[model samples]
Target: MPLLRSNTADKFIVDRRKPHRNSDVARAVRRSRDRLSQRHGTPVFDRELLKLHAHAIVGSAATIPLLVLIITAAGLLGGMAGDIVVWAFLTMTCYAGLTWVAHRVRKADASRLNTISTKRNLLAGHFISGLGWVYFATLGCVNCQVEQFPIIKAIVLLLAMAATALITSSLRGALLATFALPVAAYAYIGINSWAPIELVMTGLLALSLPFFSYVASHFNRSSVMLLSFRSEKDALIAELETAKSMSDEARRRAEEANMAKSRFLASMSHELRTPLNAILGFSEVMSNEVLGPMQNPTYRDYARDVHDSGQHLLDLINEILDLSRIEAGRYQLNEEPVRLLHIVEECCHLMELKAHNKDLRIIQEFEPELPRLFADERALRQVTLNLLSNAVKFTSTGGEIRVRVGWTAGGGQYVSIKDNGPGIPPDEIPVVLSAFGQGSIAIKSAEQGTGLGLPIVQGLIHMHGGEFELHSKLREGTEAIAIFPASRVMEVLPALPTRKVAAGGRRR
Candidate 1:
């Protein structure tokens, strides 16, 4: 079935292009698959049209012979019964041949059938049958006294033309081939007799040929359009199938690559960590002279540098792995009820010494008696530490970092870490939030970072059905807010009323 249809597309236009060069062999083998229109007419459309004409003509076969029999009966009212019978027999025989050809063509394989030859034979059959009408028009009716007999003959002839026009319309020139001769004979007979009724009948017949042809042209256009639409629909379906297969292939390759990445990281995690742990341990022991006093002071400095470098490398590795796991959806949250205030307070206390070294002050503010939140406690601690570290790193001497945990406008819980540091530019906020993306301030500052801190925080908050927002202004401060949704904000139940039961335990 066609996927599209229209009612206002009854225009007659010819396709004058040559045969398509692409897929010629395929179209020849299975004409049904042909989607191209060509000068010689599309093979599928031509075959379909021929099949249509054949089937229509075959379907109405019984009626054609009846017309001939009626004409024979009419002509019999005249004095030439024997001649009329012979003419009717010849006409019926011609029609029988046309029907047989149509039936054979219809039953045959459309892909192998010769459309050109079949059309020629059908046209020839129609023309031969018209000769019977010419002979009947000339037959004399001496014994008959019926007036307006010419009109009756004209009506019958017109009816036949109309029926033929509808059936053979798809086969170009078939209608004209059949009726042209009969119309000419009528004109000739009328001119010789010079009778009024005969002349009118002849004129009517002449005019109807073109009118019927015009109407038949519309039918032909409709058939071709239907075929064209079908071809386009098939082509679109083929393209969609091709695109879907390509998408599937791409997704399969991506899945395979992700799996390979996961395996590589999983193995490298143990292998790399083993060495980093050793480097940090030995470097710490050597720098601190845990085993013995160092002979040279320079050796102690070298050990400290090695330890610092190793620690930095370790931090980078951990950040990269965390970001990867979060992005790959492998970081499962150990969800439990944890107080947000305790986590932030502990992180502040931990960073207190580092903040004091830089002459920075860390202040903690909590909404009193805040409810426990459903989240991963370790992740919350990491998020708090990362924010406080950034605050200390970016703040100038004696700058203050304010940590606040409070309720959001939507009845949710939010932890906001605000630092009065050399604030980041508003436009660079996105750069700061993306994985491994640092801003100009961080690049210029002495402090080092993996730049995955904000992204990891965002990911953790999002996994808990929450939102993360970062607001900043130049020369002012930057505040990073992680909002947990109302769903995760554990509701506090009201204490049950003490029952003052006097007798029974079942008190209301």
Candidate 2:
């Protein structure tokens, strides 16, 4: 009983990290209640492990005397080693076989079938052990001198009888009623006079039943509490992880919306400027010479001023449109294999006249074997023009601008425009790449611009799956480079099967 009680106490050990729940206090209460219950009922054993210990205690107490009686009755103290050996083997073999069968059946199936199999094994072990007692009884009766064998034989008979009584009890009842048989049997046999005294003693064990029942109830409550605590802890951790994921997704979506708004504004500007350009171009022709300089002098001058203003506005509109298309994800690349070196040459030729006006020199350097690029030809040309124009526009007279074309370390084509003008500060690099952003030099100079050139160039390079890089130090000039993936020049053919139309028949 104390062995069972100690297992119950082990459950009360304190875990220092979790201080709120302590097992020790619960154990103390259980012990106090046990003592009180013992006074009113039978003794309680605290755990299931102690039930086996109880069986061993009962078995040893009953078997030693029975063996002595059998030996005396058979007159075998002098020469009966074989009989002793046989009895020992019989007892051990029966116990082991019953235990093995129980284990195998429990593993093979674990539902009602297993429960039935387990109880059957328990009954069988008891039945086998009882048979050994019965044999000892018969041997004692036959060999004992006088009256000595009766008491011992009677105890063995009581054990045999009760074991027989509950062998076929229903499964649920067998769990509760099995304890009664062994207890009743031993008590009746131990306390019998000419009667079976041990059998009667076993019956008195019924007095302890209520206390055992209370102990069982407490154990069940503790198991339920432990299971529930584990479930709640798991749920709480899962909820926290889900909340963190949702918060991260919301922040990403907000950033995307802001970028979309900037793109929309830029696109509107471009669309508005296209029509304005036609109007301005025709008006300028009429004011100058298309209609012979007009007959009214004042009307001619007004037309000339209007044309100039319209042209300026048209330039601003085009820049805005370029920015919008890039942001909206509506910018399409006209991919084809084209020589990058040729593109650089064209840019230089177009800007040579402007550089000459400022007394600046334009230098061009191209790698001899540079590969062609799969990119939008028109966009690439516009990117080159923007960079070269900025270089020429920023540099003072006699300053030099260099355009270099080469391949990148990552197997891409690179085009860089360098100027001898005042360079941007390191801190202002990101600002200059943004829409409407002016660098330190540009802000200080008298040059007039919409501040959209670098932003537009960066957007165009990104559309081609490339990068735009700028390196500068104040008054040391700046370098802007656009790097593109390499490609091969080939005759145009039907489109390959790369496109996958969405459910709505649109390309995502």
Candidate 3:
């Protein structure tokens, strides 16, 4: 039943809302909407506007006690605080309702946020709070002759208005409506007062309205920019995560394909080698006339050719198998202590005949008393032989090939094979190093090769914790160097002295 999918497709939507974790109350209060608007622009997101409304509601509620103290001190109630009490009660109730709405919004799913009804509720709360402040501003102590009483009342009203503006400044429309009503009421009351000092105070209050508006605008802008930056940052992080996932998947697939190729090669090599061995054996017998002499000389030559061709094919297969084993991590090295001088001399002696047949000279330079190397002797011999063979194959008749063995500057050992042949071009160095890749010169010359020689050598040297480098230039020469690390270089121990038994039969 679970496997039987529904006919209707399920809609998937990405949620981009970020969690709000900043709870530094002092930072929030200091980042008043007035200051933000001057530095930036009004918040573009509706959620930001809702947040500002909530802050304003809370700020107004906090100022209620202060309002009561000022009212009582001014003696504006004439011993009848009933009117002010009722106004305060209504203001508190409006704030409590706004607080509940804010809490609901904060708890609501992101999908339901920024709805039309939510904005309407927030604006209504702001309007009611504004009206409460306006009433306080208009009903000040008119009968009090004491100068400080009216001043204190005005100060309290101004403070409340400033707090409302700062809190709601994230939303331009909300802030304007909240502060404009109270400021206008105060201006009206001041202008109507017959006292000269009242007129002066009224003028000052009227002048401050524009400054308050400017501050509110700046605060709104700053909040908008901050919110926009956070949104952009979240988007970039999501994109990076997606890219990383794609890259990991691609790498995994590539590794699987490589393993499959290695398995196929291993299977085919075994199958092909069996038939190749029979071909080489029969051709060699016919060429050598093991049973009877060939009736014609041409028949003998043709048989010899067949044997040579088969031998070449067998060598190619062996190279391929070696490279595949190395790549598949199946090649095991039989490690032992090998003298560098001995291995190089043996490889050179084996390739000497081939060089002489081509009329080329083999030059040898050995660093005396070189330390023995801890490595696979067979692998080292193959690496040396491959380099020497390549040099002999590439060099023209009468060219000189130099082979050198020495201790490296860092107390390690190295082998260098240099040939005065038509050298490899600079661009083809990587091609020469890669498997089955032959240089252009080798391809065009009489002697061509399956490009596996250098790759095998490089792989073997790497297994021994050594480095192989091929340096060449067009028409100049080519040099191949393999350097073994110091860890693989064996240290010589001090010789023990032989003890002599002198006059063993004597007691002295």
Give the whole-model CA lDDT for all candidates, comma-separated.
Answer: 0.82, 0.61, 0.75
- Scanning candidate 2 in windows of ten residues, the lowest lDDT window is 40-49
Q: Which candidate is the best by TM-score?
A: 3
**Distance from true location, Cα of 316 in model 1, Å:** 2.8
Ordering by TM-score:
3, 1, 2
Q: Which one wins by TM-score: 1 or 3?
A: 3
> Over the stretch 379-475, how does candidate 3's per-residue lDDT look in tens digits?
9999999999999999889999999999889889999999998899899999999998988898998878999999999999999899999999888
| lDDT value, residue 456 of candidate 2 | 90
- For candidate 1, give the lDDT of residue 160: 86
Cα lDDT, model 3, residue 224 = 72
- For each candidate, give its TM-score against the true structure: 0.70, 0.47, 0.78
Backbone clashes for every candidate come to 1, 30, 11
lDDT by residue (360-397, candidate 1, tens digit) is 98888889999999899999998888888888999999
Task: List candidate 3 stretches off by more than 4 Å.
Answer: 1-96, 135-169, 194-214, 222-224, 500-508
Candidate 2 C-alpha lDDT tens digits along 133-188: 43443342334244544444445444433332222211223223434444444444
TM value for model 2:
0.47
